[model samples]
Target chain A: MSARPQVDPRGPRFAAWVTSAVLVAVLLTGWWPLLAAQVVVFAVGAFASLSAAPYSVLYRVLVAPRLGPTDEREDVAPLRFAQGVGFAFALVGTLGYAFGVPALGVVATAFALAAAFLNAAFGLCLGCETYLLLHRLPGSTRTVSDH
Target chain B: MTGALVALGTLLVAAVVGFALRARDGRVRAREDDTAARVPAEVRAALDAGARVTLVQLSTTFCAPCRQTRVLLSDLAARTDGLAHADVDLTDRPELAKALSVLRTPTTLAVDSRGVELLRVGGVPKRENLLAALAPHLPG
Candidate 1:
């Protein structure tokens, strides 16, 4: 409802790269702890300030300084929404791995990895797209102005 | 190991989807059926006076690529005569989106002064492709 902060557009992409890596680890190892850690990472980005998220912090500290400063900035709301989407997937993955449902774990992690990989490699934010589409669905009460 | 194979398969599947999306994004398509559809008053009001054609972009608050598309469409409009760019935010107006049958943000509808729909582009448009598509409708 309030004015959201703007961030360097590349920051989210960088975070997506890390997310892809983490998700790939989850898929390869089928490790519940690793997936749980990724869920926590997604939680921080979704529920807290996106700029303060772990991967964004790393980008700000290490990656951003090496690149020239860019005037183009992006709103944080969509990226935060995307993190929430990722959190849901990662949480499902963690539960699946922990509860002897390896198939669910693999499928969920693969889906998350697919999304993160798209963002990292091609700048396509599937979660953001999903948010927009959901907003356009019939009987939706949410509005762009309130976002 | 099967785990490595599964991971590799996941990466391959992601790559294929990414490529497919890349191929489809920003490609303009003709919509002759929408010729009968009238542009909304809000969209018409956003058009430049005396404009022959307007690129009406539907946008949302959190759409990142919409920002990039705005820059591209605005710059293109400024450089061309009788062409105008207007962006309508649909975040608060889901009914408008539904009425327009817009499935995504950054969907640009090219309409004439009479509010007749011309062409539409989903996602960010390819510059050369958009220019080529609009050439016949534009005055030299």
Candidate 2:
């Protein structure tokens, strides 16, 4: 019944692994530029189509081909929301590093890395969990109130 | 040296959290306080349809594992007599989630025909574990 386009579930996990690596690099080097680049990637995936994001492109062009095919497809909304969460952390980390606040930068990137690594390693999507928990919060604009 | 330590610390923390989650996920915990709790009308309706036990799955739209759980539960229900599967979307039903104290998706509640909560699983349940847990309540 859903008209939304579904994506290969593997694509997001692959992207998460790449994101974890990028976050690790950013953390190790205190590189604002690299973190900035990752922020852009997350922004694209969050605001635009997830398939158009850099890692997704890599997944389609390089990784997915080798894995043959997967019948398991996932909705894009949660993944995009997760990308938005990544963008928030990456942006904060970039700002912290660019502004000479290394502590803030380290903390933010570490959090992002933690989330990305969980998705990569255990298929646990914290951002997706956040989305669900957010909906359950009171006064959150949910239309249905009966039953 | 500090950077390496930070990175290592981050990985270690994530690993610990992941392990903890993996251990708890899909575990069915019987609710001792659910002896007097009645299921919602939706689930009670399934019981009225002659099902001895109904597996009520609470799922959200964006939950990928929920799709797999749906497949597993529906198949289980189809092959088993007196067992029904009802998937309730929590996307529009925050009140229901609150009423049931369900904070996560792919949560399965095993309810008897009288609407008592037999047991509940928080994540994607292992097939054998679920079957074993429901064995006493099921006919065969």
Candidate 3:
């Protein structure tokens, strides 16, 4: 396949910080609506282009301009796959909260928080890492790499 | 009171992760044990002929830092005589990751002439540290 189109690598990490902040809010309050909103955010970000996601838009408008030019572009596929992993956890967590399964909701939200935290703090994309693991899993939902 | 406690707990979590990762970022973890640090035959042979050092970078498709690491190592390899870089795609090669005891993407190993692993960097490597690590093996 032709080379994957490049995007500023910092964009995803910027978005992750925002996601982590929102997740921290969700965890502390145990707020269902906020949880559901985050689930939708992850779903849209994963399935649609990152620009369609809210925090990403903020990054594009506010963060990109302030930062100087970058040659550190990256493939979009992995970012999309990572978003999907985030979406899955978000979906499960939202559902658990909606269905009164507080334990599941708490655990899933905590897990997602941990992943986001890693990306933001350590530049460690647990979602990106898991994409490979998911592909190898027996019943994984990874999108086949078009490349 | 409960809300305050939850906020405190979240902050604690973030702080812990920040501290732990700070300790690892760009730090070189040496593998001086001769027998244990020996490179796999396949990996050793993959090194460029006559090269003294091989920077074998194990990366996955989705890892953003892997791209940066690739460019960094490639540039270093090109500039230095007898220095080679191998970017291994671990997406389909989990076995290799296991073989090298890799814990994450962008993990880079510096293999020397004798097929001994000199050092392994777990995250984005500091160029100064990497250069220092290779100084003994690289010819001026």
Q: List, in order, the clash count of every candidate structure.
A: 2, 0, 0
Q: After superposition, how far is residue A50 of candidate 3 from its true place, in Å?
A: 2.3
What pairs collide in candidate 3?
none
How would you encode candidate 1's per-residue C-alpha lDDT over A1-147 as one tens digit per residue? 226588889999999999999888877777789999999999888887787799999999999999999987888877887787788888888999999999898888988898899889988887665555677557442432242
TM-score of each: 0.88, 0.88, 0.84
Comparing 2 with 3 on DockQ, the higher-scoring candidate is 2
Q: Over the stretch B1-140, how does candidate 2's per-residue lDDT look in tens digits?
A: 67668889999999999999889988989976835779777656655357888899988765667877888998988988778898887776777787888887878999888888899998888888988899899886
Candidate 1's C-alpha runs over 4 A off are A1-4, A136-147, B32-35, B40-45
Give me the candidate number with maximum TM-score: 2
- Candidate 1: give the clashing pairs: A144-B91, A144-B92
Which whole-number lDDT from 0 to 100 does residue A138 have in model 2?
Answer: 70
Which runs in model 2 stand beyond 4 Å of their true positions? A1-4, A136-147, B40-48
lDDT of 3 by residue, A1-147 (tens): 328777787888899899988887887788879988988888777777776888888888999999998876778767777777787887888888889997788777877787787777776776665555565567676453433
Write out the backbone clash pairs for model 2. none
lDDT of model 1, residue B38: 76
Interface C-alpha RMSD per candidate, 1 decimal? 2.0, 2.0, 3.2
Tens digit of lDDT per residue, candidate 3, span B22-73?
6877788888565755777777877776798889888887777787788888
Query: In candidate 1 chain A, what residue range of length 10 has the lowest lDDT sum?
Result: A138-147
